[model samples]
Target: MIFNRKFGAPGLQRKKLAIISTYNENCGNASYTHVLKVAFSEIFDVDVIPLDLFLLQKPQPFINIHADAHIKSICAKLKNYDYVNIQFEAGLYGATAGAILRRMKWLIDAAPNLILTMHRVDVAETTSLIEAIGKSVRALRAGPLFHHFRNKEFSVLYHNIVLHCKEQSARKNVWIKVHAKREHRVIRDVFRFKNVIHYPLAFLNKEEQKKVKALPKADLAARFGLPQGSKLFGVFGYISNYKGIETAIKTVAQLPTDWHLVIAGSQHPQSIKAYKDVDPYLESILNLIANEDAERERKLAKLARVNHYLEKTEVVDERLTKPITDRIKFIGSLDDDDFVHVLRDIDAVVLPYIEVGQSMSGVIVLAMEAGGRVLGANNLSFAETRKYFGDTFERFDIGNHIELAQRLQAEPLEVEAARTAIFETYNIRNSVALQAQVFEGTYKNV
Candidate 1:
């Protein structure tokens, strides 16, 4: 389905740029789409098409079979655009692959200059034939009669299809470039695609940057009801088991009373329930909250444990799993204005991601752009992230609660200076201009 919004003057020259993503209009995905749309509009006329591939006409025993049909329909329509930019992610085995393959086929068949943004491809996840077959059966029963395919077999098939698409595009002299540098490097070394161009993902406008910059740290602290003198540590983005929210909580539990942690993302209700079920300490906290005397004692005990961990650098695993009592506050999901407000008050941003791939980190980039110190996980992707920040950010081992606590306690001057350098290197204006340059160069070559 296509929805067109014509803005600005009618006579202005606008290059037709098609952005394709399967993301539902959720906040995180919407934020990404919004940024890209703004950036692309600044450079050319942009059309943002969100393909609804999962919608089934009828309820059935399994997943919807018409998913591939929706993808093919979207692709066939994309032939109208001057350039097609596909956002590729390695998430679902069956549906995602079908969508990607259909879109890729359009790139090959229609021969539009294609720019594939490799977002977290090559990431491994659990899969089984039974699961795939079940989903497939559900889809088949839903109408459109798509067959069930095995997960492992589908994955191999998808990878080969992508590789073949790249090769065929190159053979046809079509411009097919990739966005992520590290992923591009690996793909080049393995698949040897001559048409691949390594372009880093970037942020949006200067107006947005200015708005974020104008927010005051003191005002943000006041808004959040945090102590005026307390140092604030922030964890931004969607909370998941692998994103290391637990580690941040543990690190906060180990910090001095002057340090407060603000977890700014909405909790995944499923993951929270799962965590509570597995951790007795979490269950205990929930149980104790009902009784006045017991709750008071439990709160004190939790505070004492936090204090002890801070004083002795001892392990704080059990205390970390307990739900937020006082020191850690859940800010829930923040709008752009509110997010900037919170960032203004934050002393540092902590990214304790367990997994890393070709994906870009908005939180890390935003914190640096807003002049907040960052402490990120030491991963291959972060190594590249560090180049953008230079000395402004610190890297700690993925799950090192103790080290994170120490860094939080240390001075922030050096980190702030490093952040300034990062801002110079990765400022949205420069990054977007660089992307425009890449697009122009690719177009000229084609």
Candidate 2:
């Protein structure tokens, strides 16, 4: 009995596909899996077997019998499917790197044809050994082991996993899907994987694209209880330190009085509930907002005193009439539909992220696709992803609040052409076709 099956024509028998990923969780993996399921379902009979994060992610001080059994049971079910796709991320499978690798090997053995989408492949950082050691020592002095050793461990685990994939691909049909071109080269050239696929995270399907209607900026401002004429700059996704939201806030502080900020997402649940620790990131952002507000008040008060002394008519600034804190709005976490709508509604999406070697960002892609102007830090991830976006996605120096402020005030680049280019290149149909061709042995990999 042949476990691997090729695709027939439309209306013919469909190949059975089992996707092992987080389905219902509130993570990027779940969102990616949903879109993957939707795209692949057009060609294959898709079943999304949710990876139980709650059970599998619990810290295993010793040999975790339950996690081992869980993996075995899940693998046992994969025998029924023609192909299995696992959304491979380090943290999703196990609490530790060793455990994740063991489970991954087990899953690989169970399926005849496996397609693994590696979300983050940190094979190595381009840091000097001395620099890395110094940084690691500083990180160790600060707190958790992960602060310094994360990249070291991640690189080792990723290398081992790719080596395992290269081995397995030799025996049976196995494919590794990566998000970036650099990652593709690393896996194919360095790891020597024959079957490798690379594509940006394309979430907005044709239908989703049609449904993405922009709520007018005026209406969004009204809904968020801001001035109708406010020039709203937005920073999206979870409220995390690495997002560089403080830079966005500082940018807004430096901008004209009409400028305001809308922080769309709340603190990530994991950041809050992970160690039962206080959310310092959130507190720091709030404190920055307060400081900016006080600074604004001081400026206005000085202006008022100057006007009084000169006996000149006090020209009140209409925008600063309200408290500065009011200008910075936090609407909390939004649903999928609301997210797209706000993406379109904002004046410009500000991504002041500090460099952390992120491979891709769904927010950046979605913002451009939704016809919103984007301003991101000139990080490597943004630069690489900018190939798909063209000149429409404006970039600033990483962590430069003044640069961000100046760019935000400047006229945005024309996005209609960029939008057209992105849609033509990365639409849902193209993505589905490429993956289907891979499955059918029709697409050639370089």
Candidate 3:
């Protein structure tokens, strides 16, 4: 049977390829890895090795037995593969670098054809070593010194080690790869690595696409106990200060009373504290009251009236956080199906990110895939994604709550139109085919 299967095959050799990542379970990274696996599976027997280095887990035995030794073990296993491709982010820089160095050493010892793809790097906007240290110092002075110092030390050590790997690779003939054009440009500008290659990340799989399409919008609202006609707005992924959830809340307050905002995903306790600390409603009310008083003193009665009206309009917002009985819902986390269903019911996906890198948003992608429109902060990545949908999506200035509210209010009809356009452009088949091309190119080059 095996002979018959190979009888007609001409000059076929199944190459073994290894793709490495620390955050393989993370949605965005996982999605990208999944696409690459599918796209490369035909030509190469792929092995996806998810490193446990950066994960929030207990330290593994071998990992604790010196970094170089752990890396050697990893390389020893990976050495048999025909091509090794590494996907790296600064989150797991030390362990990732150790693994890369070990692989490089093994390649130098015997194996070659190693490809390093930098997913996220240690830089100012993404993850800066210096800034982390600075923040750590401040954190130390503010509270616990020993814990903060240790954490900062680990980060600094990891960053230095990763930097060593990067410099070493550049000095040697190792090829460094990046996904986006902007990433490539930044890498060139910062590190000036000669062997950098620009390759865009892949899209979702057929099954994942189907899952997105099969999302039950109405069912999701029902599960969450949200009213049927509520104008739902979704904010997905890990909650963070920079994600602009507070801004989204303020925007919701500015909307009509019937409108509802759903903050999805598990909030980091720090973020919850930060939100409580900032208290956007109070901030807005104070700003309004101050403005109104100033206007009245200036004899600008019309302006004062406008400010007063705004304040009055926002009074209902205080009721939002009364309890679960209150309309505003904070669903901590959702399963994939439930998330999809919720996404479908949403009128718009709001990503008011203050800072973003080359990260392709799964929330925006899912919203678009589920036939919902997107309202993203004005950024290069968002702009690139918006290009596919044309006029369907709208962008708001980052950190500008008033502008975000105005855009949200004005663009409901436009969002629906954009939803139609988004479906046409980001259809799963086309996205998959484009990803397949990327895989084909990468495989051929490798």
Each model's backbone clash number: 6, 0, 1
Once fitted onto the true fold, the runs of candidate 1 whose alpha carbons sit more than 4 angstroms away are: 1-12, 22-24, 53-63, 92-111, 123-158, 171-180, 205-207, 218-222, 225-228, 267-324, 356-358, 413-446
Best by lDDT: 2
1 versus 2: better TM-score goes to: 2
lDDT (CA) for every model shown?
0.59, 0.79, 0.56
Q: What 10-residue stretch in candidate 3 is worst by lDDT?
A: 1-10
Winner by lDDT between candidate 2 and candidate 1: 2
- lDDT by residue (1-446, candidate 3, tens digit) is 00112212458777777777643454455656666676566556888876655321223446545644544566677767776666655444243333444344443333234566666443443335556567768876533444444445444443443454455564443455655556565556665554556543435434565566665446455666876666667688766655777667666545665566677876442223433665443355335434433543454445457769877533333323333223456787666556666666677788988764544455766665555667889876666555455655668888787887677667464355545444544444443333333333432332
Model 2 C-alpha lDDT per residue in residues 25-73, reported as the tens digit of each score: 7776787788888878877899999987767887765546788788899
Candidate 2, residue 63: CA error in Å? 9.5
TM-score of 3: 0.64
Least well predicted 10-residue stretch by lDDT in candidate 2: 1-10
RMSD of each: 9.1, 4.1, 8.7
Worst 10 residues of 1 by lDDT: 142-151
Order by TM-score, highest first = 2, 1, 3
For candidate 2, the lDDT comes to 0.79
Off by over 4 Å in 2: 1-11, 125-146, 213-218, 274-277, 298-322
